[model samples]
Target: MADPLSPFRSSLLPVGVRELAPHANPVTAILMGRGGSLRLHLHGARVEGDMLLIRPGVVHGVVLPTRGADIIYLNGLDFPSDAPLAEALEGKLAQLAGGALEGGRDAVDELRACLAASASATLPSVADVVRAIYDDPMRRMPQGELALRLGLERTKALRCFKAVTGQGFREFKLWSAVQYAAAQMKEGALVRTAAMDAGFADTAHLSRVFRRVFGLTPSAAIAGLSVN
Candidate 1:
């Protein structure tokens, strides 16, 4: 059987309307309201729009509409310029919201195509780190150990990761684990089982991290969630 979590790298999920507190995103995300404009809360400012593009590590919040929202997550190292990327994704998401697109998976595939078209070349070392984390998020690899494996000083490795991915290595690892846990839950795993599978200490630990990063408890977010 195919791995159900394979599509998580660049996937789409449909979520019900809910307000999210300010939190840092671990990957690039595009959010579109289903029936109306969603409100975005930024630093000392707020904006209302039908769609919003959030880059990795950006701290932001959202007030979704009554009809809920469609969120697309892109977990790639190459990201195009924000304006053009947002414009293209907005059109695709609009089609999805209007039922013109076949489904969330199809929409995600189209979005990935768009991303690929504009993706720039990535450094090998950076790609290596990304691959390692995604390949086994449960592994407890310390920063120093990773740096040694990469044949660089610990501080340089940290800088390289932050510069390439726009987030610290530890932050990326935690986020990857969280995403893995979410995928497990989508496959009908219990929270406790998923937490352990994702390297979380326990259910409470997973809950706290989930709420901190996503502004929703695991149970709440996993209910009726569709993972591509």
Candidate 2:
């Protein structure tokens, strides 16, 4: 049996005209040859950059330059729409655009091809994978295998993911699970089922992490759930 992957897709849009408007789709992008500024309302955090990453549900617009531009966009689904992933992609995009990143266009092409091929696959962040085991009380992921997938020694992978995500990979995975659990609870999932489906070891385990992150136990949060 194959390892279950998350659902996502990627597409490239040509840079024709620069216009200001909210992103209609959830996208992560690499803007190249951009001679103008891009403005993004990522959760109301005003972010300006030559390479903009518009995480899903983020509102953004761009100011065009008199000269033409070249752009690339990489979108994913398995990761959360947050600052960590956005920032990392932004840095990578900048390096690619400025022709300073290692492997040059070949590297960029390879990464793009990788994403395109895996559009139907679930590719978790290096951070999220680690978290699924360590920080998540419910799902205890095996570190050795995950490290191999990330192409790093187990210890090094652990360290690198932490430095980049601002949380050890395990921590992010658990938080991600917690967020999933919360959403499920809000949708009226029974505690046990919600815990299991969210990849937690058990309802008790889910409760513990939920409390740690939100300062409220899973049950308490469930009580406050309002279906709008």
Candidate 3:
């Protein structure tokens, strides 16, 4: 089966009603309930809503609605660092959560539009780096070489990448690898094969990273899901 999520620049997944263990997401994301409201536990505090905007690096777990949910993972480089992104996005979520959006893909489009309207233009060099990583998660590109390519000092390059993506360069690379592995798994690859394809040291390494970032083992998250 073709990758259902291939057309999307941001990763979007439709998940059935389930519980996700607490984990620190590497990128900003939004979870919208499909047929009912959602309950999120953030830092031991609980909040219930039809839509929830998740900030990067926050430890949170969710109780999805009975019908299911649509999760949209965003590129943090698209938004301005100083803006109140969560508040603004929550407002848009409020508008869309009322059944205004059709599905996960449509929700992604709406959210992309919202971000584009207010986001700052990305730096050319930083954008290039992001493109390269997304294009080939398995590529070995060290920060020093990247800085040289961008005509920047290594420290400046690092700072610029973090500023644009809201994640350190290393963190972004790890997230890309995880996404790559997940994509391979969606295509029916075994955990070991997917781990190797994504450049992880081994299945155990992939499992640890996956759990820390997503709060679930790869098998638990990908098994039984219909990619088609």
Candidate 4:
């Protein structure tokens, strides 16, 4: 199957976190409840709910107990409105929260479907650039290098990239790197290993960026995992 999250999918991680310190993701993040509620702290906007559509670079933290959740990431899309996408997936997530174990996977799959159904066609030039970056998300991506690769003037490339992804080249690179590293942590990789794999200068560097973007130390986020 074609990856439903091509070009614009940021990170799709499992949720139901006991607690997450304040953090920000570079892309839009949709946290949907599987079968429980969460008390969220989104940069001082406290709300408890089954779903939230966080815009790009938004700072938010959540506490999940008992019920599982799926965190969906979006690079960018032309949704008519975020409401329908959130509403449709909210039902699927609520099902999972209602003890529909089978629905857990279903919810995620359907969430992708829901997003894909509403995804706007990305412009070819922008798609080429974004897809390249995503293909090697952990690679050091300088704006000038990206411009050369895309065969466009540095200034034009910068403008075009921002126009499509709504993020500057450097900003997207940092987000992509952090996003990749966080996924590795979920799989039981040590902070150091994840940091190295994600192209950080070192664990301390990764920790700093991780703490800033996630509002919690990398150690804290990895605490929930058992290395297998």
- Give the candidate number with the greatest lDDT: 3
lDDT of 3 by residue, 84-120 (tens): 3232235645665333334455655555665443435
Better of 2 and 3 by TM-score: 3
Model 2's alpha-carbon lDDT is: 0.50
Off by over 4 Å in 3: 1-8, 77-110, 224-228
Task: Point out the worst 10-residue segment of candidate 3 by lDDT.
Answer: 80-89
In candidate 1, stretches whose alpha carbon ends up further than 4 angstroms from where it belongs are 1-8, 76-119, 224-228
User: What's the best-to-worst order under TM-score?
Assistant: 3, 1, 4, 2
**Model 4 misplaced stretches (Cα beyond 4 Å):** 1-5, 15-17, 33-35, 42-44, 66-69, 78-89, 92-119, 226-228
User: What lDDT, from 0 to 1, does candidate 1 have?
Assistant: 0.68
- lDDT by residue for model 2 (93-153), tens: 3555444222254555545443342333233665345344434445656678667867889
Q: For model 1, how does the per-residue alpha-carbon lDDT over 133-163 read when each residue is reduced to its tens digit?
A: 8888789678887787668899998887777
Better of 1 and 2 by lDDT: 1
Task: Give the Cα RMSD of candidate 1.
Answer: 5.2
Task: Kindly state the number of residue pairs that clash in model 2.
Answer: 7
Per-model CA lDDT versus the true structure: 0.68, 0.50, 0.69, 0.64
Runs with alpha carbons beyond 4 Å of true place in candidate 2: 1-139
TM-score of each: 0.75, 0.40, 0.80, 0.74
Show pairs that collide, candidate 2. Answer: 6-122, 130-170, 131-169, 131-170, 133-141, 138-200, 138-201
